[model samples]
Target: MIKTNRIRMKAKPAGNLSRDDFSVEAITIPAPASGEVLIAARYFSLDPYLTGFMRGWQGPDPRWAEGIVVGRFVAQVIESQDQRFAPGDWVQGEGGWQDTEVISADKLQKLEPIPGVPFSVYLSVLGSSGLTAWAGVNGVLKVEAGDTFTVSSAAGMVGGIAGQIAKKIGARVVGIAGGAEKCAHVVNTLGFDACVDHHSQDLQGDLATAAGAPITAHYENVGAKTLDPVLANIADRGRIALCGLIAHYQDMNPIALKEFRRLLISGVTLRGFRLPDFAADFEQASAELKAMVISGDITLQETLSHGLESAAGAFLNMLEGKGTGKHLLVLEEK
Candidate 1:
């Protein structure tokens, strides 16, 4: 028998989420049954999409309703009833906000040890975020050398990876982020050719100046505010990989895109993508991302919160753009 502490959705948020919407509780978990594994979460991932779940968005499965806060976690197997996994193996899966979870073996992915890279990266760069970046830049956009690539929220986990991958492909990458510090980090640390602060007085002009050329490809993260500017500046026949719209996540009446007609007039291609859509390619992409990180071809940044107790607050902070890089809840040190 194992008692695990976890955060549950106590009430649905009317709009912007607050810590009051969540409640922490301890539950006694049963041992894993046949073909099952009991996992102890070591790290919890806080992402903007979880906010939609809190607002009563039904996930892929109808059973993933309110009261259960959905999230990705890096966990260790404490017990296994399946032959495929043994106790003490590290894995990654949708283990929700719980400290311990008993799930089917097929639902969890066994993680391989990577020298020098922290296990937390499995939840960020080498995990869903990295795969999303790769699919959007390499798969959807098909970015090539000499292309002008633009990414919104470029200092964030997915956007950061997208911009870096574009740079590696020899594209002239420009990042758009909030505030001067984040913009600086996007360029200096993430190695983007230029970063424009979206909060600037002349956002459209700034982005235009920084890009210096009509964007050949755009990787969108923060939509609404950032989308129109990029659309306005995109070259004819440009491609856009629409990944996220963090800017409108909290708003009840989200702003409509002003330059949507640009897509039709310029013959641009805009496609929306989710990570689960490219499940088959995850293993190959993860291997490539791991090699890139090891060889310093890519850099990852993270903002960590300690303990499960801090999960709700960390999530709220991430939505508010109060943290930099990938926001993670560290249950224990690696």
Candidate 2:
């Protein structure tokens, strides 16, 4: 057995998370057992869904509080009992927030990476975040030419990609984002037709004017904060991919949107989705997003937090929607 140690963070969020809430400890990392691989984690994907588990939204879940928090990770295989994954292979999957993880073969997917693409992108654009955007834009909403596609949280990982995908497919894309800078990034960087700051006093008026025509499609991420204005301008029979309700999730609050009635009044179709719902489309979405990213059709945005210990703060920032793009932890470099 090749011996090694791992730094793992055990989180117990009493209220909102804090650095103190995360207690880092060092433990022995076991060598891979049969059909398992020992991995050295290089990057961690700090996403909002984790907050639910930490807060015990569903019930008492020890995975988040009493034990090492679980999340998607990119890692290098250091030892492998599985013939499919040899030493030095890079993989992505459900590895907890630790410096090294001993994951079963089934929990890991070998990455077929494009030349020059950073391994970190596998956790961001070319991974599940990109897939979520693809499913929301291409699968649920089916955005197409001449459509006014509006997406909330437009400067975010999924929302940015959704808008870019819509724009690429000839849709007039508009974004609803939190602040002025985020709104500008949604417009200038992601190439959306227009972007409205949700914090604005006249969000409804501004969004309607920016959209010009009735919104043919909406890819929602933020919940109540941006939903009402977007709903007010949605076209009759338009579609909505109810993606992440980050506002609700981060705050642990129930959704009560003013324009929810528009869903009924305008006869709009709203479909809430999880990745498992479109599992069959994962391969296609991953391929298309990778191609677009390589060809410069799709842009990648991310905030890198250095070190495994930084995971808690990064998770908090991501949940609070403080930064644009994917919030990631740099385990290898830090």
Candidate 3:
């Protein structure tokens, strides 16, 4: 019997999520059963969407109960009862906050590390974040040259990459983030043409000024809290790629789109999507991102928190908008 640590999400978050919402516990883990793989976690990603589960937001079937924390991770196969996965192979999968997980082979995706590219990219840029951004910008929005593309949460993993992809498309890209620092990163690091500080006293006016032109394609990550202003500035016949609604993750009140009329009058196309919605295209999309990353056409940014337990604090920092780029927990060094 092997004892390992895992964060147990025992309580439905009442208001804002806190450390009390999760309890770290050690429990015995069984060896890989038939068609299963024993994986030693290397990296755990902290994403905003995971909060919805704790707030009783159901996703797919086989729902993530309040009793266990479900998360995405990069890990190495410690043992395998399946022929496809061999010991020492790296993979990414959906699992919990535990250092090791006994996962079925089908749920995991094999990751092939590119020369000169860090493995962390597999978890961040090439994982869910990259996939989400790709699904929106490439698949849904179909961002193209001459388009004025704007993205909310522009400093986040998905947002940052989305803006960069738009830049690659030769589009005029503007971003929306909380503070001045993040806005700077959106423009300077992420290569966005302009970035709006949503925390400003006049967000609508400021964003309008920065955009310089009506937004033609928008990648939305922050839901209604930031949608209204973006809506006010959208071009007629524009398109919106809707992904995360971080602001509403903890609240259950019916979402009221104050700019619903703008969407209607402008003949805007708004599509809400999750990563799982584009499962069939994951391989080709990820390959495209990987090639871009290797050729320096795109850059990946990430922040690492040492140790598995650091996930809680890292998650807190992410939710409070303290960290730039992707927030990841380092479980194993080398």
> Who wins the TM-score comparison?
1
CA shift of 46, model 1, Å: 1.2
Model 3 regions lying over 4 Å from their true place: 57-63
TM-score (C-alpha) between model 2 and the true structure: 0.92
Cα lDDT tens digits for candidate 2, 22-94:
6567666657789998888888898877777766623233444455677788888888999999988889987
- TM-score versus the correct structure, for each prediction: 0.93, 0.92, 0.92
Deviation (Å) of 165 in candidate 2: 0.7
The residue pairs that clash in candidate 3, if any, are none
RMSD to the true structure for each prediction, in A, is 2.0, 2.4, 2.2
Q: What ordering of candidates by lDDT runs from best to worst?
A: 1, 3, 2
Q: How far is candidate 1 from the true structure (C-alpha RMSD, Å)?
A: 2.0
Model 1, stretches more than 4 Å misplaced? 61-63
What lDDT tens digits, residue by residue, belong to model 1 across residues 1-334? 7788888777767767888888888888888899999988888888888777777746754535757776889999988999989999999888668878899999998988888888999988887888999999988899999999999988899999999988999999999998889988998899999999888887889989999999999999988789999998989999999999888878868578899899999999999988888888877888888888988878979999988788888988888888678999988733
